[model samples]
Target: MRQFPLEMHHMAPGRVVEWRLRSTAGAQSPGPDGADGTADRRASFNQDKHFTVAEESRAADDPTASWIAVTFEVAGPLDEDALTGSLLAFVRRHEVLRCEFRRLAGELACAPIPAAELALDTVPVADFDRTEELTRFLVERFKRSIDTLSWPLFTMGAVLREDSATVYLAFDHIVCDGMSMPIVVQEVERGYEALRRGELPDPAPAPSYLDFAEEQRSRYLSIDEHDERLGYWKEFMASGDGEFFPRFPLELGVEPGRMYSIVNEASPLLDAAEAEVFEKACLAVDGKPFMGVLAAVAVCLREAGGPGVYRGFMPVSERGRAGWGNSVGWFVNTMPIEFDASPGRDFEQVMASVRAGFGEMIGHLDVPFVRAWELLAPREFAARSWPYPVNFFSYIDMRKCPGAERHEDWRPTSHVWSAQANGACSWFQRDAEGLHMNSIYSDTPAARRTMDGFLEALRETVREIARHGSFRRPIALTPPRRPALTPLDVAAFARRG
Candidate 1:
């Protein structure tokens, strides 16, 4: 599955139906009596705590930084009732979905909702005669409905047609991660099919994100700013001249202390066969595909007049253990890495440097990024967002994720919307179809030009590594796909974070 902005989604014209959860509170009906909910609470993991607290302090009312969503299609006409039941089952199966977060006495607390106390409300939004109209309506609806500060922080909907239906579900980032998208697709499909055949979609209870967070905080909360475990962070900061975050090497032309509308762009780099060849080439160099991708990015940036030793933030998965693998939540930690991409370095040489850098970073993953930042940069910790746009990169091999085999037929696509950003972040994803890159960055004249050139150069460099196992310095690069910026409008750039 690919992750792109909803603006790029292909929405078909059809009747729109929305499904949301309603607490069974105050219902007098005795048909399905459930126990009262509790105040069972725990300290959130560092990431969640930082995010929620930041939301509490935001001055902007933009709800654009609200959600990560998935859209997919299933065969047959709409079955509103069966689908609702299936969705309810899906939520009940994931404990994290049953959670509601709030600030209890200045601390972010996660309150768990019993599955039985949940109820689904199906509403017929409206019918649209055109895809453009449908897309416009849904984008607004998503921004309006999913709020990060609220409980039941998710929304679901579908477009109904005679032969097929498209399903879309959106959740606040506090409750899910990129890896959670495929799990949603798989479970929803299974539940819907089973419910249609009059079979129970009950599956084994997945592990709880609440428990995971509690355990994590319990272990790391006691540490102080002087802990030796933070040595890696200190060295990384020192490498950047004692700065905590790396700046995107090239000029983005952004002013300090201001946020701008974010640009979301996604496109393919290599097809499936080409990606396989790339993988084989990487293996030949004693490195993995992700390492190769990083190497190419390093080289491309270096060619763009960046530092010879590339340094930036990389997001590593925290779901390392077995139990949390299938659980849905924000299971990620951002760490810093630096590798040589100097002139005269071949692809294989850079790959070796990346492999070593990645290994060293992995060994230091025990220290949570949030904790490290709180200790190292407390002043910026209280800021509305990252102190400045952070230099960021992420790579995911989705082919190994759960339910990937069905991705071809399911057509599941994940989406992330950002209200604004000061810098750029790029995610590289490999799946059944090909290798794709999704980027969100500040929308400025210089940023647009820089990122366009960087992405194009990186693309060509990666293709060369796949075909020849190594490449010389970048040749004359191609012009960016869009030479000029398009006007950001309500349908296109409607919501602000």
Candidate 2:
């Protein structure tokens, strides 16, 4: 028998209940081929999906949790029974929610839990004064470590107050991504309305995540087609210098049992008018908005690090396949983006180069990053070091997605997990207010100042493009020498705090 650790914190002024999920289906014995008997009883994820499952399984105790959470504020009438029913219905509609990872023949495999054995815990709160405490409780609940070996790696609960109730939904990253949150919200809302009206919600026509995973596995297993792409990746990694990015000067020496704290700095990159001009400029160069922004980031890195090649990780969505766009699952694949911003190149030329590189990467998206790493790096070297990208970039435009609008006057907000382990990550969001960029970095003092300067440099680069319609002239670059911070600077910063 295998057991997984479970932790729950209940802060509301009510009784707390815990439910243990069990499979109602009978267990199967091993077959003649020596394969695990359950292999035939469970649905399987593709190679890429299994990669994430394996990763989470290894880091089961990691305090840096992998979860996606969304909060919804519902005002006016509150129907507790209807909401509970809706949530259960939502769970039954998605196959991924009923699945768990199990060890089969020395490998991790996913199998569905019987619906009759599924469990949901309820906590009734009566005090409005406990709002803050309840919020923290739910946040911790959402951020709590997940046991991937257990079925249904998701939780749904509500903190009911007199005037309003806040619905909190958390899903393990192994089963969902950022794009899946809105879909889940929509379904929950639809289910709630239908249940309130004494009717069952109509099922969506979207394909199951399991089907998508099976297709992905088949495509990735096609050795003849992927071998050529693997060759390209091996060559790409071989051509680059094997050195990691330079560290910030303020980074202290590694201390025993010390975890790196991540800090985020946000800045308004462009106003609505400036964003319009930036979009027009990108169109003039036959580039996309993200490409234009990436060009600016490359310039920032080149200026700071003294040019060579700036490589970063960019996540590519695999939902482009027909009928898979609406499926809720982990369908993102991270790929490396290398930019050569050598001195003496005009901004237009840089944009063209970036566009070309992006086109080439799109052509070879079938090759997974882990497979390429295994083929490219030596075994001994791989054991000693992690080949994570020095920088990461992600962009999201909520306006472009359907069913993302406010529902029934309820406000919805998404809280994404930070990619601090990657050292530096920049997320750009396009909203009604304007264009905003948030840079998350290691918490060293030097990293903070550098990120501040980096944001300023990014703004200046964009402004230059907007003003001149191109980067015909070279922009000023920061010197490679690290700046010395005096004691007075630290004292003053602390005083300001």
On residues 1-497, what C-alpha lDDT tens digit does candidate 2 reach at each position? 00001111222322222222334444542353222333322233333334444455357544344556665555545687777767766676676676666556654455645445444545543443553465455556655535344445776666565565556677777788777866777777777878888998755434667776666556654454246677656545555554332222223223323345666445567766787788789889888777888888887777776454656667787877567676777777667667676676777778888898788777878765554554445352243124332567777765554455553244444554532343566778654434667555667666666676677677878877777767655555543433532111111211231
**lDDT at 254, model 2:** 30
Which residue runs of candidate 1 sit more than 4 Å off their true CA positions? 27-39, 50-54, 57-64, 477-497
Per-residue lDDT value at 103 in model 1: 58
Task: Write the residue-wise lDDT of candidate 1 on 159-188 in tens digits.
Answer: 899988889999878888888888888888
Name the candidate that leads on lDDT: 1
TM-score of 1: 0.92
